[model samples]
Target: MDIKKIAVIAGDVIGPEVVSEGVKVMKKAAEIDGRISFEFTYFPWGCEFYLEQGKMMDEDGVCPA
Candidate 1:
């Protein structure tokens, strides 16, 4: 089996709802395949965050370095 890492940012308003459904679909696909798994990491970079912090995402924004 293979493992895949996913970064999820469920933004404000409808973004959260939409992201939830998309995650469900991905999980279903992985289950049916029986060969791949997903690990999701959630971030707080959304409209609300922007309103509060004046930035949509972090200064680094999940960068790998």
Candidate 2:
């Protein structure tokens, strides 16, 4: 089976709720297919973070090399 990487930024309170449902559906679909797998990396970047830190993400959410 192949592996897939998914970067998730659950922005605000409502964003998390929506992202959870999406993750659930994807997991169920994967189970039925019995194929590719997913690796999710959650980034805590959003309006709330901005309000506290004055930025939505670190360096505009670009992953460093």
Best by TM-score: 2
The window of 10 residues in a row where model 1 has the poorest summed lDDT is 8-17
Residue 36's lDDT within candidate 2 is 79
lDDT of candidate 1 over 3-64, digit per residue (tens): 99999988766588899999999999999999999999999887789899998888889587
lDDT per model vs. reference? 0.90, 0.83
How well does model 1 score by local distance difference test? 0.90
TM-score of 1: 0.81
Q: For model 2, how does the per-residue alpha-carbon lDDT over 1-65 read when each residue is reduced to its tens digit?
A: 87788988886666899998898888888888889778888888888888989977888578665
